[model samples]
Target: MSTDSVLRFITAGSVDDGKSTLIGRLLFDSQSLLADQVAALYHGKHKRTADGVPDFAQLTDGLAAEREQGITIDVAYRYFATPARKFIIADTPGHEQYTRNMVTGASTADAAIILIDATRLDYSEHTPALLPQTRRHSAILKLLGTAHIIVAVNKLDLLDYSEEKFNAIKRAYSKLASALDLHHISYVPISALNGDNIVTASAHMLWYQGQPLLRLLENLPVANRNSQLLSAPALFPVQRVARLDGSSADDFRGYQGRLEQGSLCVGDSIRIEPAGQNSTITAIYTPAGQVEQAQAGSVLTIVLADDIDISRGDSIVAADSTLQPTRNISASVCWFDSKPLNATRRYWLKHTTQTVYTRIRQVDYLLDVQSLNHRQDSDSLQLNDIGRIQLSVQKPIVATTYQANPATGAFILIDEATNHTVAAGMITSLV
Candidate 1:
């Protein structure tokens, strides 16, 4: 059964687990790469790996430093298509320093292909040892709401392409997956460097009766985009003010933004949050034509009946919605900066489109990545640390819990002095 759905997925694992090589192999075997991309492998800088083939890892590890260091430092995204499906792959960095990059890549992914190097594990027994990053990334993927998880047992060639070894690794990961409550978990055995069990069934691994990697992706069901959005309250974050024909004679003003959640219709009453101004939708504008109704994910211009003082960073939400506007936020934050998070220091908090001054009122606890438990003794958090923290904002923000509405419940902490993103946060509870 062929499915033409587009799947957005991320490949994550510990450093040198072959995340980039897997992507390169997928592109190469699928005939997805252009002629020059393949030809360049024969020339400049792109040297072959030990297998005497063009370095497939070079396809996704595009940064100069990454190439020089033989690592992936940033999130390198690549797109390819088979007749049955189209795919967007985010090959994220596996280094501890770039954990934030992995978080960013998995945040929007529908599924995650987490690679495990067979060479590193003692797979003679049923429960093989797992790398720390494997468990950590699995937890992060679950936290980010990735719907599907595929534990790809990579580099089986190193293990003599043994089915028993693959089964042992699968059994080991299953225990961890069950602990994390990850429902849609599957496992596949393949060597990305040798192109076995990737595009087609492997002759070396005849015992693996499951479909190839490409086939599994081709038939994987993608969750409907509209269903989740429609279940949440309508959210419209004003991007910019649109004035038609630059004319004030008619006082024409339209607010433009992508409808982030739910559906909106003409004559529907809505409230502009933080200001609490109420108005009725006078009209909706789209490139095709004017419409009386618009669904989530649509980018449209909305005209309100009453003249309201709305600007960029303002949220227009359903009038009867229960989303609370608050200055106190308690969230699970992943600290991204080299400097530890200081309770006495203030930051630039950005949520949706609103930016305001904020500070850590309290650090509730820090998470132990290995055990996935909370430790309350920490006074501050360092780089790549995930913790529960309370934030006091200078202005009230209209937000919902991330479990309820992801679009309105997420935010980022930025350093004002250097203007770098320091933390990524998801609202757990608000006061």
Candidate 2:
């Protein structure tokens, strides 16, 4: 990875699962907070318990809803820099009503930290109502979209810091991970609220030897050009059409848009899809000034060599690598509406800048997260219910399966009457 690129990670788990405290520990013990900020946090309760330790989760829980209720309700972003790397942590809410919030956070994350309470490792007991654990097939289902994982079996103090207890939880979670085809997951036993084995090593777990949590985060392997940047096709989705009032002497026009994929440079011949227009890059202008070249992830306005009817909601791609365009597709939909997925219903599909009408064609199977099996006869999926749905759109849109390209695989279902987001979906298989 280059210095300009940033690796984003999201923290997820059940309510009271210690997500906030873990993140607060990462920031505080790494010396990321300033003196005044630290002082404010120190005086929150104005007194410490007999343990003489300040509650670190106080740092991240700033909103009154979070502080008063003592639970995370919204996504909070934290930024910090180490000598070797820069990091962005997206702390998402864990309540079932906020499953949409979890999806909102995880969509851009390169990794996920799944925190599990060691004391609440009860598999035999069933949650009385299905609503309590909506869409969770255990932790695995909540995290299948994530590329990498770090399972923090937190609150080890409640377990007397026992290695046996930690290992049991680890083994069980690992088994569920393997069943879900979740890869590259590592585990650590730590007490989030107390800050042991997170930013520093612990004396209680003398038998265990490994990098501390902060060290693990700093050294985690990140993929570079060879995998994500270079191998994929060049895609430039028009976010906006930058028009400069009038045309030149001969009515010369240029289509302005940002590069959304691989590098695009001057003199490179590209084709605009759906329109089938051919053009060459004539100029690249960053807000700073004109640049001779640009690469993936850059937001620059461009000028074309030939006249083309390019507009927002359209895409420009490399001549040789045009992504498949489709009207019917299969997606992994996480139901976000209070009402169940009305199978006989239709909604608006928003992909990038384009919005089209769409209808659910079929519901293949819903996942049973714990066992990671398919619950075959699901009639409907209510709020936070995740299931496989076949969709038929009114117009063709460009998208690849998430495994191929995450940004391209995304789409949104909007309620036509309310204009509210009703579902968050990822294109799992483009049919």
Candidate 3:
């Protein structure tokens, strides 16, 4: 597959907003479904909608529990390709309790299709009425750094494909999108059930002039990690040690990892972190063969001139431009576990490859999803709560602010005793 041909995106919205159906329609209309899969849609005890057509939502709601409950409980990923582009769709749950799943799905998305049910709104005066879940998902997307956002106004068939209703939603959501500072924001009227404005234009909605959902996604530009190279140096968070026992070289040791950002070449001076030792790149090897250089996304084995004391969590960065190791950091955190995050609690912080014990120094404030306002009096972060917190790590970690370089700036808070991931955090500043 071509590098630019693949687009990783997710579907998110309030419950019963047709997120799964939208995905099923995208797959079905694209002719990506197999004959047996199509047969199951008709044969299984699967329920059909009021229109007498098989419920396309069944395509994604694969779990028996999900089919019985008629709600997406976990993240369902589907793959499809058009003549123009290949897509990896993450169908995320829309319930309030499953907000963490949506965040996890959208973390790597190039764009997001947020489905807003048109029937729920009063289309008289161009007003946009949204559920609380909508606001929560929007807030999390902003925090997670999802760049492209397309608001898909779904269930237009229920509204008789009225242009006024679609326009009203567009106006209302455009205001909200502006408030969230989302880039490349666009609106489309679609009915996932009837296949209107999905893969092709809907005849009922001739008044609306916009590309279909699939086309818009195909045209959207993927974020270029290599573009950030000018500002940040190559960052390699060692995943494992690669040792080869061969006839010619008995002591061939290489560090293996994905080159997260920037670029690296042979003979460049690199600094290994936590210990802060300097070495030169003796060789760069890929599966095909050794190459002169590698870009941001390549995973390769790098042999250093000097065998230094390096482990899985240590980072190798350009010597001239390296992240400063620090113990205290202020970050924006999304609490996901059942346990609330309190200032007195200690957790395991996994940043890049390094795992260290960390304590919550302070809970600065909790963000109100609807208004995007910060409440200062909060002492703890509940499930799916977004808050800013101060953390004091047991050991210093080489890092940069998330905005500067995402590869080196993101981390997860894990429960030390249970080993469950409790929160996802982004470094805002070094303290």
User: Compared with the true structure, what per-residue lDDT tens digits does model 2 show for residues 90-191?
Assistant: 898878778788788887777888888777666343321112342262342343366578888789888789888777777776666666667878788898
Residue 308's lDDT in candidate 1? 84
Clashing pairs in 3: none
**Best-matching candidate per TM-score:** 1
Could you give me the TM-score of model 2 versus the true structure? 0.89
Instruction: Write candidate 1's Cα lDDT for 66-115 as tens digits.
Output: 88888999999999999888999999989989999999999889889999
- The true-structure Cα RMSD of candidate 3 reads 2.7
Local distance difference test, each candidate: 0.87, 0.74, 0.86
Candidate 2: where are CA atoms >4 Å away?
1-6, 45-52, 123-145, 225-227, 247-252
* Per-model C-alpha RMSD: 2.2, 3.4, 2.7
Pairs clashing in candidate 2?
137-369, 137-370
- Model 1: lDDT of residue 317: 87
Q: Write the per-residue lDDT of candidate 3 for residues 1-431, one digit (tens) a residue.
A: 13455799999989989999999898888999999888766665757675447678888997999988899989999999887888999999999888888988988887899999988876556466677788788887888788788999998888789888888888877777778787778899999988999999999899889999888988888766566654467788899997777455568889998887778899999998778889999899888899989888788899999978888988888898646678899999999989888667789999887799999999999998877789999989999899999999998888888877776788999998889999999899996
In angstroms, how far off is 49's CA in candidate 2? 6.8
